[model samples]
Target: MPESDPLQPGSPESDALFELEPRAAETVGFAQLARLPLTELVAPDWAEALAPVEDALREVLAFLAAEAADGHEVLPPPSYLLRAFRQPLAGVRVLIVGQDPYPTPGHAVGLSFAVDGRTRPIPRSLANIYKELDADLGLAPRIHGDLGRWAEQGVLLLNRVMSVRSGAARSHRNRGWEAITAAAISAVADRRTADGGPTPFVAILWGRDAWSVRALLGTAPVIASAHPSPLSASRGFFGSRPFSQANALLQAQGNGTVDWELPPLP
Candidate 1:
């Protein structure tokens, strides 16, 4: 099956709302493109090529917007942000597809999730996973540097639901967000490859909600593991090994090792 309700809650209303948004029409059209910061946005080539599928994008956005208007409190409409981040989709080899944005204020910036290395603590499971991997791989310091190094090799960090506005925090809303995330990933996966080839993308699903969307990935080769939170650790989701596993898979597929460049924490 194609993974039901990638958004949290997966309610009928929420889905309907996502279907109504005019993201596609707006993205290609001048008005919508003008709203975004050209420098920060993803380039236009990929999005332009996908213009034929604008209706689908619009539908998803409409459904999301309606849900928010109906008090589902979804994340901010990320269509503009999505367009800005379009560059990665062109030929991205690995995508770390997360669930929704973080619940904390000012963390979700359309496409990026902020994990404050100096302030907000790293999730314990994530920390443990990194520590374990570092130990096994003979890498020391057990810090963000290791993960940062992995990012340089063309690993694109993406959340399923990209934008959650500040002050909109609800468990149910988060569930709805998950559904939106799933829908977004589906959208990207549907894009035709640059050379008219298969879209060879690897997705890393971290956490429980992320894991739940496995069906959406189809045969795209996914890495399903614990959420990297303290809560997940209680359930026995320990391993520094998953990183190595991910690396090995990428190498086997000829994706090569990640660059490990530290992403701006988040």
Candidate 2:
């Protein structure tokens, strides 16, 4: 069953607003992440987990606001920042971390490498990912690039730095997002079952950037591989079978496997 929204309208959860933009935000509650505008769109569980890095989040947001004020084009519109958390944190059955948001203007929807469609040519890394997905899941590739379905099924499709300046990849790397997300990584790692064991969620760490969070993942099953970038894909990503492997691990842990076959886009 789909989980009930804890941030329903008119409830106290909706009243807790930590506004990132001057305009009205969503009806969603920020939970413990109420202090950081960057995480305000996340689920209550994720927000609460992010509480420890509130100060780091604040610093990051302030810097972003300042950058915007300086006339820089920050990609992945603010409204899409928390799309990855739409399914809520507690429901997270898988975690896939990317390095940063796409540098192209319309290429990023805030869920890390996912574009709006699978047109003529997409990012090299994304194309590589699709190739691997096809090989691992034994499913024909769809032309669309939207990965929101994966996110809806409890995949935390997060990026190390959630946003980047238009045409400038890794522009926000040195900003405070690393610290804030590091804390998030730690919190997710800390999630424990009734028997005090690691949760069933599987972590797929691609490349060094994503692997950096490995230390914080505790005992969660990890499927580490070379990045699905043209530069490194041939080295390891091509035959990694991460999608199948991740689902296999989840099943071994007594959890439902993810349906990696994405549906066609309208």
Candidate 3:
């Protein structure tokens, strides 16, 4: 689809899309979606709003369940699947969509490009992201890769496909996660203030995979950049200034700017 005009903060066009239908399945109650340990994966607040798309969520869980049944190992562990939504949904001020979890052991921790703890030798793509972050904000990069701070600051560090087979990248590419995450994106876009005021978010879409979901972000301002891989970082990601640009957009939308700083390494 060709790019449309940038969505105004509270334009009706954007609000209309906020009534998110399941992108790949029918809406149904959680009873039919199985009483799986979904709460263990997604935060309670988000799980309640996501109940409308229980069918798609069910498909995602079923896929993972089947994969586990077949003895296939999934990355980021099971409980961290919806770690992206650990913060309040209404607090989300920005969304960064990644393609999938890192395939390397001890690398995937639900949040995109983030590891479980302060680990050395972060993924190359994440290293590139650090470089861009420094260039964009004139701050020194930290040694650790846990981005939970960004999530707590209202940045939804979501991966379109949340998991992968251990050691195998893109192993779960064609599964139903795309639909489930897409619906989640729309849900965030539709979020309003407690008084029913407009509360738009900024979307930083990196790489082709992330850009593929740009259309679902409603009227939120979008900043697009090439993938932060060494192969492409210099081409566009280096100068993208996504962190600064996202803050600018958030301010323009009448929201508070995000403090993009990561915590210091212990």
Best by TM-score: 2
Q: Per-residue CA lDDT of candidate 2, range 1-266, in tens?
A: 01123444444543344233313233322222223343445667877887777777666655665666577766665556556655677788989999998888767777877876644467888888989988888777767778878887888888988879889989899887888778777777788889977778899999999998998898888999999888999999999999999888989989898888888662
Query: Could you tell me every candidate's TM-score relative to the true structure?
Result: 0.59, 0.84, 0.82
> Scored by Cα lDDT, where does model 1 land?
0.49
> lDDT score, residue 51, model 2?
73
Q: Report the C-alpha lDDT of model 1 over 103-124, residue by residue, as the tens digit.
A: 5542333433333344345445
Q: After superposition, how far is residue 110 of candidate 3 from its true place, in Å?
A: 0.4
Clashes of each: 48, 0, 0
What lDDT score goes with residue 9 in model 1? Answer: 29
Find the 10 residues in a row with the least total lDDT in model 3. 24-33
lDDT (CA) per prediction: 0.49, 0.74, 0.74
Q: Which candidate, 1 or 3, has the higher lDDT?
A: 3
Among residues 3 or more apart in sequence or in different chains, the pairs in candidate 3 whose N, CA or C atoms overlap within 3 Å are: none
Residues 145-166, candidate 3: write the lDDT tens digits.
8887888888889999988999
